[model samples]
Target: MAPRILLCGDVMGCLNQLFKRVSSVNKSAGPFDALFCVGQFFPESSDQLDEFMDYIEGRAQVPLPTYFIGDYGFGAPKVLLTASKEPANCGFKMDGLKVCENLYWLKGSGKFSLLGLSIAYLSGRQSSDVQQYGVYSQDDVDALRAVAEEPGIVDLFLTNEWPSGVTNRANASDVPAGLSDSMGSDSTVAELVGEIRPRYHISGTKGIYYAREPYSNIEAVHVTRFIGLASVGNKDKQKFIHAISPTPASTMSSTEIATKTTNTTLSPYTFVEKGSSPKDTTKRSSDSVSDSQYWRYDVSQKRQRHGAGDGDKLCFKFLSSGSCPRGQKCNFRHDFDAREQYIRGVCFDFLNKGKCERGPDCSFKHSLQHEGENYADRRPRSENSSSKRSKECWFCLSSPNVELHLITSIGENYYCALAKGPVVEDHVLLIPVEHLPNTLSPSAEHEVELSKFQNSLRMYYKSQGKQVIFFEWVSKRSSHANLQVVPIPSSKAALVEKIFSLAAEKLGFKFVAKKFDSDSDGRKFLRAQFDGNSSLFYVELPGSTILLHQIEDNEKFPSQFGREVVSGLLNIADKADWRNCKYSKVEETKMVEDFKSRFQEFDPNC
Candidate 1:
């Protein structure tokens, strides 16, 4: 039997009411392991302090082994200070410290095992000011990240504030009654949840109970269920406590651990670019998506046309778009800074406060290599060597322009989504989460996740009585990689190789066929076929046969070669051009939801 635990929401210093309800629940659901609380553990006013003090001072007994966060109410500082002075509460404790009999305070952020369940927690809401008793700091977040990197899955994660955008794909009816999707939600908490990938993320402080449908996590083999409890005692009588008896992940088999419910949705914490308008993201016109594909080439051409002068700098508008309205008449330079482009813009937090709380984790540029000598000296030289995607790139997950509604699944290094202006139904693209030019050769860990996605998709399509073909065109223009996965009727599976070869012959090129048992071996063969910098295209068929082609310099290859061949094999040549297959945003959203629902069973991360 698993450990039975009771989880509760905000107590708000109502010790008597909370205890009364706990005692009642304990009588009915007798012999539970422990009780955990989140949000406003202390009272807001001094009048209620006496009741809170009674429990802490042992005048009134706590009913069960109760632990709590949200240590920031009226009497929190004095009580915590007194506890810290005790010998048992001394140094760097991750687990709770006993303040009184049956009562414990979980301070800061840490992870510990109790009753065979691995639990991780962040004790307070995010704060910008220096860390004190009630607020959590950057150190706490970093500390948890280190713990999250350790071995097995975390069974439960406790936090005070709700993660930002927690209701992104949730139904309006399923959301809490009075709470908005993003109100009072902290982005830092969201990031931590994404990284930690806990099985159950319990939070409070919103005063409305919401038991969200289980959500899939990026790069993890398990799903996370978020439950936000309401206040302990409220007029609406909303549920403030929940009971669960979960078997620890360590004891469960791999198959049992990966089980997912039918309603599992994609992770809600999609990287959203700040300050982007709704219109920018929802524009799914074929022309816009196509133009955005070669944005790097466009930037390069603009730089060539308007050379950077001694007194001029790059035009931000021109750099973002291929063309600026001013054209040749602009006063500023039209060239962009190649080094600064990848980091997006300067870090506003660093600029305003001489220091960024995110530090190395920030996605924005801190300072120019030649500018800010003091800051430059402090930064590691290798920090700038690593590449990151700009928000302007259409495929980058952090970009404001990304079509969030189309995304189905996200992993650590890659994500899967329906293609914009898809060639056919169930047309999916497996894209690198980072900004990368090609997928000819990926790292070992990346290859493992990529293979899992491929196998999952293969099984999914197989169940539909169809065969899947994967293809990618490594462009010389250095654009983002999108490995196209298309499904064809089983009857037409034999014709796939024939059609691709015919298309290649028509384009005055021939493919070299290679056999490999696994994706890793195929990648090794590809790396040996051509240098990493060369442009190439490849197709992986059902029988482990890969058709590889290395495009020579200035080779005239059609951009739609793979889609055209697959379209012909599926007898949908008219839909070969993605523009012809465009769907309305409403229809696209329905398509994504449908794919997510059907694919949940085969989702490896689920």
Candidate 2:
């Protein structure tokens, strides 16, 4: 059974009243293990000073295993000074502070287990002043971020400040329209909460109780619930206290739970190695054919038909593949500089004469090399090693080092391939033929082909009594784009949009949704609909229910965020880790052949 915890916000040194209230509530509340108090635990006025000092001086005793965050109030410095002298209160431990017999103070930031629940906290308020009781420092944020980076689940997260933009998420009568971001709200807090993706996010000091819906974070498989509490002892009786028992970590995916091992090893999925690697572009390296080149869940292959590219277009094979079949008859540019310029996405005219008339929307790399910077010396691994990015980029079609036999179908600008590790037999990836940074950057022609591919899959899935879903995580930096095409049971298809919106709202935000009048006519909607701020993009329930999220600078965006959602929706979350779903190459090949035969009628390219 999960432990029941009582959460209160901003006691304001009203310990006598706070405990009295806690006791009254606990009478029927039944076996509450701990009471966590946020906001100002110190007395705001002199009237409560004498009574607050009584507990510190041993004249009175705390009733339960009470934990408080606000440590700066009238009589706090003097009283806490004495407690600091005790052996138990020594050092900078985030936990284990002996404020009184049953009282504990969560100083600074740290994580600890309480009643089998993992609790993380950043105590104190947002302030630059070092001496302020509620003042949270950069050091605290830094320490908390380190904890959040670990692979696991935090059952409960406590903060003195609310996450920024939380109030704008839900429509509540108490939350005034256009209420300025709360003074007690911190964007850093929101970023960390997004990174940690805790089950429950609790905060106080704003004096309002807002229980938000569970939101799916970018990096984490689970959704987080944000709850803000009102100031204790406030006359309006605004809800100052909340209670909840967390679901056991065992119930969650292993990828979502943190273990107690000392191993701090990094996985290739999250880590990017620096420096150049030895490779020969003279010919396709034997390493490319080896399975060692593949990262977790990497999948790519091409079904290039004859006479596809324009006669004037550049041939990537002649430039990087070390050989060309057409030889003198090849109509493509074979110059190294021309190919490199193309790879960098520089406008061809700009490369030729150093000028481009199309401006920013030209969809080309537009940057000048600064003087004194050695372009050759600082060339990225992708440039130095011709196949490096393609070899590793699962969505790069030019890479011969892809899951070759997995290609299902090929369209004009897009193609379909089996997911490297699929939960469902029909799971597939619809990827762009070009190395566009993300889904949001697709050009008009690319969008048209993509829509056709989606429509074909949607129609086919409906005929099969299933629903198709398309989702992708759009990165701010360069990454080959692909949309996850998953087919869910028809019964649950109707619930996908509502379930996602409800989930997004839990993290104190909402997913802005739009529906196109028709699958083919959606030309201008996305060119401006998704601007610079947007990071996540998806198409649910076929070509409808388009959703996007604007990412923050500090947000932790997961590479496999969309797949994690599908895993949960299918109720096989344990297999959410792609590693668990891996099959032998032979098995994968056979599976591909089976899917190809079955997908013939619905294959748009076919």
Candidate 3:
């Protein structure tokens, strides 16, 4: 059974009125698990400050596990700062402090789960200027957008500002006329609601109670219900409290999803079930099939150890359009990230810190890369391959712009970076410290060192029950070449082989398997084939099988074909473009730190 929750509008430091109202509600509706208050938790006038402090300081008692977000008023900063200092209040999600027992503050912006329900919040009064007390910061929006990216559900979204156009868009005549006009809906908050697509959206500061009908969202499975409340001590005696028990729609069953997604056209950016694949894959007679097609895998014959991966999957229609007919019966990933790794905008991390955290995982281009300086020259590198190459090569390990913190480990010849937009946590790039065009023709010593590095990685991932796949696209214009290393569940390794072959086949090129006596021999063979003009597609399979495809100068080959294969195999095909997986620098820093900790023991250079 779902827990009962009581939600209220601004309290305005009227503890006496609040107590009386709660007592009345308790008698009438009685028991509720939690009470959430929004907008102006502090007093408007000096007379009410002492009474509010009394309740916050614990001189008086808080009735329940009361959480609130009215971040401004007479004594807000003073109380919040004090609570921030308390050790118990510092939460993992960066959620705010506890003022007194059972009383808490939801500061800044973040989300957390309560009673099996997900809740996201943005705290601050609406303002145009960058005021400390009011107005949302870019960081807040960035963090919220990041939250919106995670896979799954956000049951409730709480904000201090009403979403702009809520009244007009909702046309909720039930709300008092022009009440939301003076305040209007906050554009940022409104946009957030549209992106988050939560089951329930609650806001306050308009000083009126409004419960709009569930509205449609094209990219989400469940409809959203918007509620606005008036001040607690309003002279009009408008409702200050509202109560409801909503079963978190995130827990819906598959039967519900099947029902809701009838005729649902999923978003182009999301997963397209293989059965519904838009790409036509007509098999030719095996006798006439190219050597590449020989690797074709039968996905039907494979058994997925886990049923379709994460069970918290969202409804297809909900993810595609933010609204589903299933209500709470559907299942799929409602979290924006779950929809696809490739998002249709700039990197969220770059927007926040001018740097992207995901490296290769991020599908979006780093806006900083477009700065006047040649991005290739700006990467970190060692001494004088040319002051020019190091300066122009963005991938050079010695470049000033290099996010050194992203380096996972140091090797004798080559080093690794967590891809700026990594497809997975351990996805890394193996690059030579000295600038070079491609891995096709490394000297024997470098080959041995690179081999050792690969061996070490192979052994480590094997212990973890995973397989690491290596691929590279050496551009003629590339300042340096780095081997793209990705890890996939061993179960998927067979699938990876078949997909790459299919991808190459679709592009009218065949990946010809070439066996070499050793790594050095393979490098020499590839170097002769590079011809200083033709582009190369290369892959290293799990059992030391190597496939190479050459796209001569005259051919039009999809440069993204390699990444497409990898992303498709991982079910994140949207992120093949790199522009799709943009994430925050803070998160990237975390990714680096995590990699460092995991790879430290195996690191040969460091």
Work out the TM-score per prediction: 0.49, 0.44, 0.50
| Candidates ranked by TM-score | 3, 1, 2
List, residue by residue over 1-606, the lDDT tens digit for candidate 2: 878899999888877888888888789776788899888788888998888878876798787898878677777777666776788666556664888888888877778767757789987767667555556665456456556644346788998888765554232234544445647777667656755667788988777777765554443445566788889878878899888887555346444443322322221111112111212112222222211121111122221443433333444333322223334444444444443443444444444335555454233454532223222223333554434445444566676546668889887788899998887868899887766666556777887788778888887777788887777766444356677888999877777777667556544456777777764534355456567444555555554546666654334344455665667677776455565578999999999998888778988898
Kindly list the per-residue Cα lDDT of model 3 for residues 271-369, writing each as its tens digit. 122223323223222132221111111122321543543233233333333333233333333333222211334443443234654464333455532
Worst 10 residues of 2 by lDDT: 267-276
Look at candidate 3 and tell me the lDDT of residue 374: 30
Q: Candidate 3 deviates by what RMSD?
A: 16.0
Provide the overall lDDT of each model, using Cα atoms, as 2-decimal numbers.
0.73, 0.64, 0.65
For candidate 3, the TM-score is 0.50
Q: Model 2: how far is 551 from its true place, Å? A: 22
- Candidate 3: segments with Cα more than 4 A from true spot: 1-6, 16-34, 46-50, 74-93, 110-120, 128-156, 169-184, 195-200, 213-225, 233-410, 415-606
Alpha-carbon RMSD of each model: 17.4, 19.8, 16.0
